[model samples]
Target chain A: MSAPAILEVDITRKSFAGRDGAAQLVLEDLRFRLAPREIVAVVGPSGCGKTTLLRLIDGLDHDFTGRIVWHATDRPRIGTVFQEPRLLPWRTVRQNLTLVAAGRDALADELLHALGLWPFRDAYPPQISLGMARRAAIARAFAIDPDLVLLDEPFVSLDPTMTERGRDVLLDAWRRRPTAALIVTHDMDDAAALADRVLLLSANPARIVADVAIPPDQRRAGPEAAHVLAQSLRQARAAETRPGGAISGSSGRR
Target chain B: MLPAASTVAGAMLHEAVAGPLLANLGITLARVVAAFTVAMVFGTALGIAMGVWRRLDLALDSWVTVLLNLPALVVIVLMYVWFGLNEWAAIAAVALNKLPSTAVTLREGARALDRGLEEMAESFRMGRWARLRHVVLPQLAPYLFAAARSGLAIIWKIVLVVELLGRSNGVGFQIESYFQLFDVTGILAYTLAFILVVQAIEWVLLQPLERRANRWRR
Candidate 1:
């Protein structure tokens, strides 16, 4: 909590033209920051500009206002697991990992083994199950050994068991690499299980409602603690929906 | 009169072994190979360029449409007349005829490329060559195969016309000479021999390659 922030996000206003030629605001006065090696989960309602925020940070969308500052010599190396797997369909699992590593990096092979994708190394995307494909995508993220990783709903469509497995592999890779991660998810359980902090967002024209931190001891307190934290997060977001209920960490400017 | 099937078969075997049938067929096949190579290579390059850049696509789109709808016979005659009946002219004419369709198919392929995958590649900052090899080319494989299949068929057909009109030693020329003599067996023999060669190519080369490239689809 005390380390200097590695990435500072201050978006004063971001919007795009609607279908009727009118501008629709998505993120307004939205601001957040990630310290070195921090893991933050952004939980928001559907279509609440969570993905848009990640896109802004990732430079996928440049139409947004304000700036994202990276406190480093060079732009931070990034590994992203998008909402979809986005694995190359024609490439084998191993080939997909090796592609971004600029040939074959040892980290690629090690991540493959750690992520339990080594056995499916030769399989193409269509040949593998959805869970495996998603895991492969995560492995590719870690293979680059980036300074920051962005995950947009890493387990959106998977069943509960697969979701847990996905989180397990993600955490495993993260522990080994220990880089900062910004995870955008709709599920608070996903946030509690994976992120050290949670950022709650309001509905349309999303603004940060609350940024809740999980205590270090409570995080180590296992599934019960995560469940209790998840419940509190839901309550905080629910409470922030009222007229005078915006919590701390809202409108983070400058 | 049309010759009997057995008689045509006998003539085909005899002509393949002992007549101008082999020599003429060889000439036509060479043109097919040359023109097919030129059309595929140039068409793919042009199509990818158009696919990647909207300005290039817009500028060249109408020109491609004109070429696509242009009559092959007209192009062949013009090439022969303008280029002075040279071998290069024949190849050029045939290649030009097939070029438009190949470019069109690849253009669509380039345009429909999976944007999500492209974003992934961009985020990873893949180099141009690596992106082409791992991301772009694989996605373009189906369209490339489509172009090659149609190009091979069309190039061979146009090569015969080029040979019949300008070049003097090909299956088309051989058929013309036999037409003057009114020899049905000779005509049938050369036609049958070429059909068999094309069939061999389709079975041996194209089908195998298409299967191998698309194996991942299964």
Candidate 2:
């Protein structure tokens, strides 16, 4: 038998209030499953509720409809990295990481060292550059040894060079712990570079528009594959915007 | 001119004025410290309660608003009338006056905490106390220190006013005595000494604490 699904989302639906005071459906009939150590990238236009989906998976949002089941005997701990590096302004990089580590001091330091952050461990968040701050945030998430990790545009603000470095660090860290991960991003390059499967959503009350499995070799190839994937994503998105298609219902809002 | 200057300086340093100045400074320091301690403990507790419980925030919002706006002198006078003109009454009045401000400041900080962090803590299966000590407390430290420093400074000045109006001893009493005697030199000496003490506190306590709190910010 195939490995059991570590996470399952069945017909999940979410809506919000529209300008006309009507209920605007944000996501509808969205279903997916992930096996252990799987990395799924969720791609969508702005305001497609990608972050909202992550929130629902992490149990931070309860206003949605459907069942999100974790197969683990116990509810697995979740670690999340937001678009912004949300390190505490009052704590050093090391202290911030340790706060979430919960007595895993050795593990915290090891992650920091692996991320090339050991030299600046004592530096406060503000003293560090934007890229460094993002690294620290990544280190903090890894320190917790979570069974599931969620990334919501975690590398949006980085430059090209920093983005490449961040992607490597994230992949390496994920490989070490081997947790199921769901990454939400607008950047096709990011989705193609890191994901085992790329899931696409349409704007406004989002629904699954496409789910493409990326070959293992392609993910490891990096930039060249990223560029090709970006073009394909653009073509797919354009097809989505056509008069009659899978994303037609939500196209008006987009 | 030199002889006149010497005479003024000599009079300002006179034993009668200097003795009371030192004693009153000690008394005032003690009162401020006591009042600040009370404010910190009670105010922080209240602030956390208000932050954590929406019902409590609704229930106590009006009361905090009233206390924050009430004139300090009126509160001091009421305390004197209600509890008698004693050290306990004076200290209590100063602390009560300072409490609302600290609570309001800290409440904002507590309320602004990231919900993600709290969820992360809960997902880890951390108990209530562990969550508080590990997650909540670290995030709350910067706000707590800020409230304490400002609250201390405000309470210190209020204590002096409370002492002057109600008490028989303290920096305020010395100032009153100097005023009655029309002793300008004596008044200046007491005022100068009190100013120096406040400056000393800023240097030794508030500045260092502020630095420590922001050390993580770089």
Candidate 3:
């Protein structure tokens, strides 16, 4: 018997209103699937629809055209850790987690401890440091034990050391629950470090331009593996820049 | 005549002024407390509803706007006629004067909340009650404190007006009596007492709550 598909997005297309009121496509004919516990990293330029894609997948954006199919036997619960910590300034870290954890204070406490936020549990969002706030948000996300996690630039604002710590915490938690995740990021290192498969998107009116699977052996090799993956990404970018092909078509050959 | 009058005023300020001033202060404080409680509860509920529901906001928008702009004197007079100049009527008038201000302030606060946090809450499968308690209420504290402080200040003044206009007791009525009798010392005593009450509210209530609310916002 085969494992079930945890998530599937079929031929998704999203557009926004342009400055002149013209329709600006952000994503075109996007398609993907995730098996149980699969971790996919999405990379693209700043204005590209990377966040849009994640929004579409998370069911936050229903204005787009496409189908997102969740195949788990039970309805998969979705959780997101956004670019900013986005914690309520008035809420203590513990209270923020309790919002979703409901009757699971123990789980929230454990997660907060794991994320190095136990001491700041009673502290409000504005009282904590940016890194601590982000960690709190991460803890809140994981405390729910979601079936699928959507992370949109979750570590974008952190310093190198903080980013590395955050990555470790996220990986540890992901390992524990083993949930599928779709992460949108601009950092190649982040993609290589955390993702099992790296999906590249084109500039605005984004479409998947490349999807490269990293072997388990390669994933264990650290920065050297990231450097190698970066090379593949450069080639993919080169192919994307080639004339006479729509950005979405670039992923076809991959 | 002036020397004897000054001596009489001084003695009057010491005895007759102090006791009534204190009693009236207590009465005014009680009225403010009651009015503020009613405003805070109903205002917050209404504000949250207005903030969260577009249709309800639109429906009630004109009503709130009109009430907010309505003259406090007119409301007080209407309440006196309708409710017969009782304590409840006075309290209700003060609360009504306060409600729209509280609701407007809280509504703005609710509208200013980050959608990202709301979405994060939803994605976690947070129930409605949990979301309100954790997500909504927490974010609402700053605004609530603000509205409470301003509403208290406003209600304190309104309560005095309500007392003076139709009621038999209160600092406002006492002041009116001094005005009619042309007793400057009595007037100054009540004014000083009311000022002290305002200062007490600032120091004892609002300052502490504001400090606590903003403590984590650093």
Using lDDT as the measure, the top candidate is 1
DockQ of 3: 0.57
- For each candidate, the DockQ is 0.76, 0.39, 0.57
- lDDT (10s digit) by residue, model 3, range A64-110: 88788878445677778888887877778998887776577888888
lDDT of 2 by residue, B1-218 (tens): 12344555565467336466567788898998899999988998899889888999999999999999999999999999999989999999999999998888778878987786676565445678967775787788888878877887798779878978999888788778878998776666666667778889889988897776556653
DockQ ranking from best candidate downward = 1, 3, 2
Report the lDDT of model 1 for residue B65: 99
Best by DockQ: 1
Candidate 3 docks at the CAPRI level of medium
Residue B135, model 3, lDDT: 73
lDDT of each: 0.87, 0.80, 0.79
Q: Give the per-residue lDDT of model 1 (tens digit) for B1-218.
A: 87799999999988878877788889899999999999999999999999989999999999999999999999999998898999999999999999999999999999999999989998888888988888899899999999998898888888888888888899988888888999999988888888899999999999998888887886
lDDT digits (tens) for residues A104-219 of candidate 1: 46999999999999999998899999899999999998888888999999999898778878888998999889999999988888898888888888767788888888887766
Model 2 regions lying over 4 Å from their true place: A229-243, A248-254, B1-23, B40-66, B103-154, B177-184
- Cα lDDT tens digits, model 2, A22-80, are 98888898999988888899988766888888878877778878998888746677778
